[model samples]
Target: MSNEDFLENEDNLFVQKRVPHDDLHELVKYGDHPIYQGLKDDQSKAWIKKSLFEKLDYQTKLNCVKEEAMVIALERYLIPMISENQETSYNLALIRICTTLTKGWFRQFAIDNYPQLINLDKDLLSIARNVIEKFPIKRKKPVLLTHDPETRVIFDSIRPYTEILSFFDKLEYDPDDFDITGIKITSPVNGNISVTAIITTLCKYNFSCNPSASWSASVIILPSKEMEIFLRNYKSSKYELISDLTTKYIFSLRIKANTSGTSWGVGEDIWKPIYVEAKSADDVASILEIPGLTGDLLFKYVLDFLNPTLARNGETPLKHWVNELKSEGAIPIKPEQHLWYHAWNYELKSLFM
Candidate 1:
């Protein structure tokens, strides 16, 4: 085939093909991150330029170009060249790059910076569209912020379903009336049935909150599907499991600023099957209470819950309390864990804050 014919035929061929390059996939899949940033650096950029212009077979050329470097070339150089010369016949090297690195910033930077390429180059455009169609941009979820610290405080209690619903209803009625700085719930994953139901009810209750409330609240709505999966399939060490569960994979609920009405864990890491035995909504009302349950303390709780034998072997509640207090700089010197039981059992005046 003539070079021109090869270019045209190659475009058609690659547009329909799904070439898998592992490094390229990672770079494009996580385009927003710094993983591809090095490609734009001076040394990498030189390498990318050399690889792109080199005269080589298609597969050999692709192998020569680092995935991240290819992405950088397309975003910073190649696409811009194509944008300026839309009708020019790009070589097989350029065509393969476009089709191979089809997602994330590679697709986005092209679409945004050189929109004309869509109309000007059908083969490249089709490949880009395919990637976008396959991996569409996700919409950010609406965050629901509860001003009352009580939402988090009550999370520990075994409240009934109706009572929990009532609490939410009250918040929906006048979220602004409350002290406006407590819990922040950020929904990370989409299509969570539980999250969807909760958000739907929250949106339903036309509650109002202060127009000017700014408090850095705690509480992240971590991705729990994996946690559920882990709980159902817990075949690992307690520490390893807890580490996976508690490490940075957590997300929270966050309320957006200046919105009239905005709407909005425990299994993969510390798979506590006891949580599964809860028979009804009422029984599981407290399942979502996962604020401030981080660090060594959280791991301790999960270990004890999953293995009660360990708890029994450990010191009693009083002993734990005394030991904690004896340790200097232990705020709430009395330690709140003991207070929770005593206050509830003895019906004594206590503070949750």
Candidate 2:
């Protein structure tokens, strides 16, 4: 049977579930058993159980419980029943548990946050590489993701929206083929973002409002018949068109508008995104509303009006960037975890590097 079918088969003997509280009476009857001492630096059984209870995240906690359950189940039942030679189903369940746990762990890992992993030991790095291999993703047909870790994880869980998403794992979209649409802010927006304009597909597609769909706010109506494609993708699916490819770490994007014309704003001294000057969301929507903007000298109205200080280049995958450090034999010191880890999920800002 396939992996999914086997996992669903209730007729199979062993699956990872909680060992009954009543079942633990058997362990206590053994009285200070050596088998129980093997947990977490030989801590007392109570301490071991407490540690598992304290774990956060659905999968991590489940993994801990499954591990403890397996140990007890093997010692109490499987080993004793060895003479019966009916270990195949039990062994399969245990193996599946480990495999499932590992994939879950990999999904949760964010390589960019841990700068220390730039130089992993050969043994550990091999396993890390293998886990990444299990999910092969191509960067082309990129989806916009949030910089916020909490929101990013939520986005990651609902990924591959294949109905709405255009995924090309190996082949890439041509950068030359993709340019900003002609629609740009008509009037001076100044610094207020809520006034920024947007079109169909998303209403709360603002950085100030819904951070998850903010990418739509920026690149409204990707030009060409592609707009029809995007609109069709948007209209027909319940799934959101955008997705976060990486769980918590993705490469950044940097582009200074390759300008067509130059227009001086009312107060041009301040430097911010052209979207900041938007009078309304539709004004922001107008930035790329129409199709076919070959910046060539159409009117010279669309200026390369970007802050010179902004990073000119876009982002690279953390894996690609991190490997360079490994090649250079760098081993960074571990950084402290955030004190308020989930606090930034509500922050309002464009997700730049």
Candidate 3:
């Protein structure tokens, strides 16, 4: 049987009801156990019973329990089972747990957040990667997601009616193709784990807001052929689009003038992108002087316009710009846009770096 079929049936072996108080205690029992102490030993598996597995599996489905708790429960189970042996039963159980837990939001969440936990064991990493590979790839209808209050505030602040075209991975759409109204943000992957985490977190957040139908749908737009090879062969590269062919971490957002998709506020050539390096404060000056831009009036307008999409990538453009400028020179202008630019210009600027 297929992995899905196996998981679907195995799920029945676990209880499908609310986790009882006793079960929660059982979960905590395993949680307190030092599962991480040993490697490749059957003794580790001795503590985790079938009942505990059922409890962990059942609680994973509940919204009340935080994802970290489920992950802890998973690690607790994994440490023991994987430590014991690579027997068929152990391997199959790992696959089932990986596949079931890494579905929907949890799939992207794991990829975006937990690299260390995944790579902690070679066998464990294989299971996680396999789960990612087998995820259903198809065009899902655009549906609104329920975000927590803080995230909701961030979502609400974003100005509506904008068209963003993201070309990081290719599924049904080609990278050169521009007859679309989506947003593309590429991860500035430089092989450093922390930097990559920042890049992926931003990309995932953007994807969360406007996820494509499949992994292939996010086209990786390559700036050069060399970087493409580096990324594809990088071993831990998560973006399925980077194969020996394409790559780039470009972000573009355009304001839609009306309900009809035809009219654009920036320019008719929406396909042509103006790449801006987030690291350079000088780049913002050049953008301000772009021909057809009304300068002063459009300064805040442009920043506000890009705010929604950029916010997804874990850095606010204006906030970053304002903070960067304070270090360079005296603040200019008193308007709220300029004020926002000036006030935080002197604040701590270490986070994004």
> Highest lDDT among the candidates is held by which one?
3
Tens digit of per-residue lDDT, candidate 2, span 1-353: 11222122111111122233223323323234423243335342233333533444544444333333343333334433432222342343234334332223321332222232122112322322332354333243332212345434433332321122222222232322222222323212322211111121112211111011111112222223443454455543223333221111111122111111010110011111212211111222244322332222111111111101111111111122233444564422122112111111111112322
State candidate 3's TM-score.
0.24
lDDT of 3 by residue, 48-100 (tens): 23333334443332221232233333333332233333233333433333344
Per-residue CA lDDT of model 1 for 1-353, tens digit only, reads 11121122121110121222232334343234333333333422212223333344443333323333343333323333443331232333334334443343343433343333322322333333454466443453432222235434433331122111222233323332221111112222222322101211001112122111221111112224533566468677643543344332221111212212110000011111110000112212223443443322222222222221111111122233334444644333332432222212221121222
Which ranges in model 1 have alpha carbons more than 4 Å from their true place? Answer: 1-22, 25-115, 119-162, 166-216, 219-353
Q: What local distance difference test score does each model get?
A: 0.27, 0.25, 0.28
Error of 1 at 156 (Å): 11
Best by TM-score: 3
Candidate 3: list runs displaced more than 4 Å. 1-32, 37-69, 72-275, 278-293, 303-306, 311-313, 316-353
Ten contiguous residues minimizing lDDT sum, candidate 3: 257-266
Clashes of 1: 16
Candidate 3 to native Cα RMSD, angstroms: 20.6
lDDT of 1 at 135: 48
